[model samples]
Target: MKKFTSIKLAIAAACLAASSAQADTILGLYAGAQYWQVEPEGQFGSSDDQQAAFNYDDDAQGSFYVALEHPVPLIPNIKIRQTQLEVAGSQNMSFNFNGTAFDGKVSTEADLSNTDLTLYYEVLDNGLASLDFGVTVKSLDGEIMVMDDDGTSEMQELTGYVPMGYLAAQVGLPLTGLSLYGDVSVLSIGDHSLTDYQAGIAYAFVDNIAVDISAQLGYRSFKLELDDLDGIHSDLEFSGAYAGLEVHF
Candidate 1:
């Protein structure tokens, strides 16, 4: 009788262990598509004799994310994890300018894109709500063009790469078959600065199928140094609306 009782107790303990493991954490795969519209608010240089004009058109952007998370053993109330996220986007712009009475117009275009790999940890995770904080290292690439609008100038293009750091926060809430999420991030690149803010909602029809829609706003400012000319400082700001999809596994 004692042996049988011991066997039953062992079975109960095993079931409890499995239940605890299932409750402890989760891992997920995610992907999405985003649309971005960038507008330039300021000029690169200031010279009454050198007048400049810019024209920008919007573009579509997309990205993917994979995440793994578990509740801390020592502090079960808090969740800790690591996440890998990557995003890329591009912009096309035209510039026109004239200096030294050499009446000229320049057609210029640039591509601004970056990829971010980050580690994120969450402080709160209930079935309905959660909060996350993290940092990311970003790789940036940019291009610029200069031309004569009067068809009498040569075309010049400049390209370079830079590294930047970002701090981000996100909050999520679930409602019915849909989940609402919002995120904000601040970035520092050399002497330049960028701020990004976004908020949106998502719907999950099943465990692995979902769609997300959001709106994003961004602002950037930096100083420009040109050869054989006085150093110029400028500020650029842009705001836009975006709609995207999200898939989870």
Candidate 2:
């Protein structure tokens, strides 16, 4: 009778451990917000030769994301992110912006705010590292307004959807609440291309049984090269440092 009771108790313990492990992989939610201080570079116009250079100063922008993960077989996780970016500058040059000719001192304002929807699968998620790869569809809905000294202005609309490839990876230090991570999305089709990437270090300040909070500092760069996708032909870039907080549950 003693031998039979010991066997039953061991089986129950094993079942309990298995149940706990399965629960850990069932669901997860992550949310984060970032503040980016970026410096603008490059020019915009109807062509490479007739472009107006931007005299932009450093600007601050905001971005945020929410992601949901599940362990369901054959199903991928989803993340939605929104980014805010805009800059204004003045230059004394001759340029043709979308068939409108501008001379003398002209002020230009460009807004490049966009939203991203990503569907990814977690390929590897061990204790020390993780990797995720998938597809991202970015929606850009902004405009460019240029005004000359005569108060005449031209508005060029920038509205389009771009598809890109996404990949992310992270490496964690054992017994330390620190990690290094990077992610990127890229696309190149014909004469137009877009690339956005970030590399950063994160430290977990709060580690709980059901939640984790982390602070991340990193560098982010975004480059956009277009061939009249929205009646605007331009090459532009915004690159700089960013800081953010993340919460995972």
Score each candidate by Cα lDDT: 0.43, 0.91
Instruction: Kindly list the per-residue Cα lDDT of model 1 for residues 65-171, writing each as its tens digit.
Output: 44445554432222122212221222233433323222323344544344545555666666567776665544444433344445443322223333333333434
Off by over 4 Å in 1: 1-26, 37-40, 45-53, 68-103, 150-175, 188-191, 208-234
What would the C-alpha RMSD of candidate 1 be, to one decimal place?
8.6
For residues 1-249, write the lDDT of model 2, one tens digit per residue.
999999999999899777755666788889999999999988888766677787987899999999999999788899999999998898888777877888899999999999999999999999689999999999999999998999889998899899999999999988889999999999999989999999999999998656789999999999999887877777899999999999988
lDDT of 2 at 164: 99
Indicate the TM-score of model 2.
Answer: 0.91
The positional error of residue 248 in candidate 2, measured at the CA in angstroms, is: 0.3
Looking at model 2, report the run of 10 residues with the lowest lDDT sum. 16-25
